[model samples]
Target: MPDRIFLIHGYVEDPTIFDKLVPLLPPADYVPVNLADEFLRWQPINSVDARQVAQYLTNQYKITAEDTVIGHSMGGWIGIHIKQLTGAAVVQISTWTDQEKIKFPTHNLSVLRFFLKTGLTQSRFLTSFFLKQYPFDESTELYAHLLDNANKMSRLYIWQQLQTLFAKVSPLTVQPDLRIHARADNIVAPPDETFVEVPGDHFSLVFHAELVAEPIRTIIGNRPITDIW
Candidate 1:
């Protein structure tokens, strides 16, 4: 049997975001989870929640160590926390690094405010309207997928997660980290303090599978995973 991997989605996203990448991945089983549901279940986000989620998903699939974790954006942060919690090798894409707030103050504040307000609303139209911020060009298949997911994601759950996120003392911190970022990214900039350069911005970085797959495969092959915490 192939090893197992847990692919966690970023804020305001669902598991389908990894559809393209998941298939291209090596033979390992991939379990994707909705971030909103996770946040809903775990009131205060921390390493413990991440560990529980990882263990639950792995158990559901009957997977063991030798699996890796792949996450993007907020998911990337979750990946690190999972690593700390589970002692898994992690491949973080377009990850928000510790230097982010200091490097891009305005962008960070804007995103925070948007998350704060968006997370509190439960409207489908409002949620759809908000996800339009992702850099999906009109003609791509990815655009259609985003549109479909806009309707599927739970607005109330997203809002609640954001509310909890707002109450967080510090969203990003340094510890057992592996991260990737686009050098030209404006959403999370300066690309330093535990981030590697990828091809595009946040959305593109997540969808770009080839760039991500190798790193993930390498990590999985290198070490055994564990439910550390």
Candidate 2:
């Protein structure tokens, strides 16, 4: 049987973010988990989210070992924990190492924090406004969908996630098997090894799914499939 490939999306993002990229990947059983989906009900901390994902894999898919897990940003953080639980090989994209934190401007972050604390983040208009401040293809439908997903997430859930992001990550609990980063990425610090550098900013990397998927297919040594584009 082909290896299972699990895709974990980052904060304020849903599984659909990987829609374009998934089809380009080599043939395999693909599972994309939306962290935001259970945010309101679970209000999960990082560790909790990881455990839940591990449990989901075990109960639903009977996944045990040697699975390929890919995560983006905060999702990458959770992926490391899943790796520990399942002995899975992990690929983290634009993910921060335990030593690093996202370098958002303090002023802007503070403003965002205030909104989260006050529940203003629940408003689609405000959430969209905050998201628009980031570098993305604002004209694209992907951006619109992302904004919609962000609005669906609860402010409390976002606050908890922000806390997890800023919290100190334990040292090398589980190292990623491969790291992918963009030269122009503003969200996370660049990785040191086993990395593939691609063009575009952080969000743009998702938009240019082929660039991201091709390197992953190579790393996994999966048979080449025809390009979707």
Candidate 3:
């Protein structure tokens, strides 16, 4: 049995966001897990979520070290934890380390806090307006989707979990994870990623298939599967 490729999306994002990249690779097995549920319920802050996700898939589908996992933003954080549990090869995209928070701007952090406290659903315009001000260069399509389906409180809970996790990460534990970020990204900052440099902002960074697939292909030690379309 071939190892599987588990793709995790960021906060307020759905699995379809990975549609493009999923087809570009070989057919091992692909699972799209929704991190947020109806009412936008975010999972409790625990590294165990990652472990559980890995184990759940492994039981349902055979997974091993040869298998690859890719995650974006908060999803990347989950992927890291999953790696700890599974020792599977990982792909970290537009992600941050526990230590990387030190580099984020204070004002942005303030915006994050405000966004979380107010819950974005009630103030969609205001939330989108604030994110536009940031340095993100990705397509707003996904954000627009999130705005419609997301529960602000759920988003806040996940954000808080991420912040807490980042604060406590030890420096020695920061391993050589393959991180790919957009050069113009403002969400997590391109510099925070270890293997940086790709096109588009945080949202588009994942939405645009071509921009992300090449680097991901390299990291997974697989040759690029040329697009048929």
lDDT of each: 0.55, 0.66, 0.59
lDDT of 2 at 37: 53
| lDDT (C-alpha) at residue 197 in model 1 | 60
**What is the Å distance of residue 166 in model 2 from its true position?**
2.8
User: For candidate 2, which ten residues in a row score worst on lDDT?
Assistant: 220-229
lDDT of 1 at 28: 58
TM-score of each: 0.63, 0.74, 0.68
> Whole-model lDDT for model 2 versus the true structure?
0.66
Per-candidate count of clashing residue pairs (backbone under 3 Å): 1, 0, 3
Prediction RMSDs, each to the true structure: 6.2, 5.0, 5.5
In TM-score terms, which candidate is top? 2
Off by over 4 Å in 1: 1-3, 36-67, 99-155, 164-166, 169-177, 205-207, 224-229
Model 1 TM-score is 0.63
Clashing pairs in 3: 137-201, 138-201, 138-204
